[model samples]
Target: MNLTIDEIQDFKGKYPKQIWSLFFSEMWERFCFYGMRGMLVFFMISQLNFHEKEANLQYGATQAFVYAFTFVGGLFADKILGFRKSLFWGGLLMIVGSLILATNPHDFFFLGIAFTVVGTGFFKPNISSMVGQLYKPNDSRADAGFSLFYAGINLGALLGGYLCIAIGKGEIFSSIISESMRWNVAFGLAAFVMVISLINFVFTQRSLGTIGLQPGHPESELQSAPMPKWKEYGVYILSLIFIPIIMKMVSVPEYTDYFMLTVGPLTLIYLFYEMSKVTAAERKKLWAALVFILFSILFWGIYEQSGGSLSIFAAKNLNKDLLGLDPNGVNNSGGAFFIIFLAPLLGLLWIWMSKRKIEPNTIIKFGLGFIFLGLGYYVLFATRLFADLQGITSLNFFTIALLVITLGELCLSPIGLSIMTKLSTKNLQGMMMGMWFLASAYGQYVAGIIGASLVSTNENASNYDALITYTEGYKQLAIYAIIAGVVLILISPLVKKLMQGVK
Candidate 1:
């Protein structure tokens, strides 16, 4: 039953068997990741004694570093460590970070978060690049495979998002753990699941054949001399060296802004330099990918409010009787819950449309993503009208908002992953994937600013005052989203031409 890389790529059925291994591995890692994410704002506000505005900025800075590092990680993997080694190293770091937080979240908060930012940088982009390698270029099934992979991400997010928040807030496990220790238990759970993720990957990696081997390894398809011991050691040493530096930057929102401003242009310069070395056709495709990357920054910026401003909104303004659970839990897990059900149906829908020659082009899909995103924000804004005198809104309105947002995500994210692989030259695939996530870093950064601005400056701001401020912000976001969607649709032909026949 041994299968070569070629055989795995060409296997009969809707998905490769290797995908299941990757799916499980990614699922647990996401559990760890989203679990931590869902806890951050609430943890800072409750445990760290941070104000709402400060907590949102901190969340933004932490998340921005996590994603920006993906570019660095991707570049290093492309040049040296390869995907397998990068992922393993990243997982170990993540586990260590989680354990540190579990030990004493209040005192070591930034220190633990810094470690996770670095670990995620190394781990996240590489596995995704490996998934891209599972398919032949231009494979018609690529989108379906990515859609399924996207579902695995959500499955983990769904579990971690709800469970971790519930535990840390002491909504569940109240009898077993003291209220003081619940946060530590939540963090410990993240570390535990990360161990499982690393173990799963270790046992299943044999099935990958030579797909993720180091570039110069003896068994690699490149047929080059082995990479020098010094280079491998150097990458590991440099990552460790950067931990304190990352800690400092992440602790200061101003520093993060400076880092964000510099890193993006520099990344573009590097990409353009690489693009200059490729054929004209490949360059056109890379340009098309860049367009998608740029649009995604705005898409994620608005969509990600659920984790920032909306997280606080759920805790403060929304009714907590959502199925007898915390509204914040619903806010964190709702989109993923919808995605798990929606992804497969949408994947099949794409297949059905393709067979009938009625499938929308990727450009058109991107436009539609924004349209749905705008509509979703409008729904969130509408929650204001449903609020009682105390400013508590209907849980029903919030749930509907998440469903519309999920529809928008289905169009962009999985397709974005698939298109990055298709458009890039093989050598640049990892870096391009990194760039895609780096765009998300920008989105996170902007989302933080937006969230911070919407918060009332008065310490004595009322629930109703907060509700009015936040809902106004949501309305502005909706307008911008609709405008972006219309512009993208109007210019789709130009972008489609740049794609140079890529679907």
Candidate 2:
């Protein structure tokens, strides 16, 4: 029953059986992740009594740390724990964190968030790296595999995004669960699913064969180890030790800013140090990957408004009835809903285009993603024009905007993951994946700042004032997105050269 790495990667058909296992594992993990994400700003504003701007900053800081830790997690996985152990450890932490939040979200909010942040850092990047390992280098089916994997991620997001916020807001289970107990139930749901994710991995990881084994461990002799057991134990101990530090930084937005500023530069310096050792071709590909990373930060900064400013906007200025559902739930889940349906179709489209030798290169796809992103934000801005006298906008317009944003995300995110693996050497795969998610951390950090700037400083500002402010900010974002798209397209040729035929 045990398949070697070659046997697994060389399997017939569109995907390896192991992909399904990873898929389910990632699905439940994403449910936990997006569920917690959907609740953060809402919880801060309503329960923690944070102002809108302050909540935005805190949300950004928390999400940023969650992603930034991914780089650290990836490094540890690359150097010590390997993907399998890293994922298990991360899942355990996430379950504990969710339980902490469920115990008393209002009292222990920052502590719970800090644990989840660290947990996510370990869980997020390594699994995706493992998926990359399932495919041989330059395997044409890799994109499709990633695309399918992306759908599983969105499936989880759709469920958790809708359910968690809906439950926490008392929109669902109002009869059985009192308002006092709703938030607890929501947090509890995340923990429960995390347990499922970890258990799924535990039972199915054998299918992965040698794919996630620790660095320097040969596939032929799985028991042989180049690294010391003490080093592996050290990683676990250090991660736990850093939890309090993470808790402190996330609690104070200013401290997050300091951490962000220092961490990014230090990561770059370290990457360059590694780059000095790679071949010229690999270095060029790494440069191409860097370009993608840089652009992604901008893309996510604009796209991630859904969690911060857009969440608040849905609460304050959007119509509550979209088929009798809460607008906040719709805002949180809408993109994922669309992606679940769209990712496969897009993947097929890419395959079709490739057969004709006319597939747009990854750079062009990245550019197009930004263009769609711009259009999506423009639609969001236009919602202000449709506002009723009460300043509440149509949910239809909101849904349409989500669809457009989903299109943009489909173009960039999955492709970005696929390309990161394609571009990095085997030894650097985990690091490059970490860097990609770290870019998202920067994006999340910037999104918070942008969201905060748009929020009215006056505590008594009306919904109409909020609509005006947020729409104008969205308009600015649309313009920037369009400009970035155009610039990326213009420079695509240069980037293509740097890719060195990675398409």
Candidate 3:
């Protein structure tokens, strides 16, 4: 018995009650996730004694798997475990990973990283797919719903960013905890919040009814027959074998490059295979989705620098303090701050525009995002011209650059999530969401490559050299993004036609 899409959306208000449950669950999960993200590279550099290029490579590899695994995780959820079960297992794995970090990050860093990556693969895509399941196809509220969900993600990021930094650098916990143990404490807090997320979801998930119920559930029909038990176990076993392979890739930057070259073509082949099974209209929509996915790689490849080169730039080039806080902590908070203040307004703006039938189509919105991305980087490129003899520039320049990027993110991210759900067929929703993350995986990998190029091994390198390298990279990226955006704008009408009337 398939539940009607409208029945799935049957709630009085603009949002269903279950959305709050999912919201809070995702919120705490993100708190744990982003808290760790905010501090990862710094931890590698400060605690693990990794060089800038080394840390960037490791960061890129780790993030790459964290997303790439989503493709597998989503497939498993759609076929065998169902979304709810996958979510729980993934959340549990993440909790274990976080606890391992808290116990000892240095000795168990690789193990902890492995666990979180696998956990995120299972948890991330399934949770997002469930969010899409809450609404009917093309629900007018879909974009706004995703915006609010995006806000929840940032809310957790805000708290996580601030809390982890406070634990690491602030004096509030200094009396009870020593500075040496601060990073551990921060990780412990992330674990604590994850526990809260798991518990909350376990209790409140009934409100979601049949939304993500898997195995014999109607939504499960979207996928093919589940593999034999032996085959399923074999897949998991084969995946586990890759852990060591990934460890090796993280150790060597060249391996990471090779891995991307391999995965990029494989991803395209997989997309075409899935498209082969769908109707022409759905295939066209998938093509549109691919266009957005392609541009997204460019957008995220640069945007993710907040954790890579830009992070190093802030630490080495910018002033030590920002508003009386650690510059790294303050820098990490930019995304959250922008989302907290701007997400609601954007949400309302989308709904308002939609009501009047004047909302920008998805392709146009993607182009707009690229334009902002270009402007953001170009802003930094301009600041390079103002560098003094020592190559130090105003902190405001960095802040403004980040702020502009946040604008680009707000345009692209939530909208990307919404459009992926809308454009994908019901059966392939989870897989497509994973594909979205896969594109992000490419972006993160390329970002690391780009970051690696900026690293000067002189150890005594001059600030001017670093400034020159960073700004030059930013200039090239700005030009690339703006040109891509303009080209997308030109083809948007064609892309919109390919969308087959999906709004």
Which digits, one per residue and each the tens of the lDDT, describe model 2 over residues 12-94?
98777888889899999999998999999999999989988999999899999999999999999988889888989999999
TM-score of each: 0.98, 0.98, 0.92
Q: For candidate 1, write residues 1-503 as lDDT tens digits.
A: 25567877888888888888998899999999889989999888988888999989988888889989999999999889999999999999999999999999988998899899999999999999889889988777888889999998889999999999999998898899998899999999999999999999998788998887888987776677889989999999999998999999998999999999999999999999999999999999999999999999999888888888999999999896567768988999999999999998898889888879898889888999999999999999999999988989988788999999899999999999999999999899889999999999999988888889999998897899899999999999999998999999999999999998888
Deviation from native of the Cα of residue 269 in model 2, angstroms: 0.5
Per-residue alpha-carbon lDDT of model 3 for 250-351, expressed as tens digits? 567677678788988987898899899999989999999998888898888888888888778767767643465556766777778788788778888988
Give the runs in model 1 whose Cα sits over 4 Å from its true position.
none
Best by lDDT: 2
Q: Candidates' lDDT values, in order?
A: 0.91, 0.92, 0.81
Residue clash pairs of candidate 1: none
lDDT of residue 106 for candidate 2: 89
lDDT of 3: 0.81
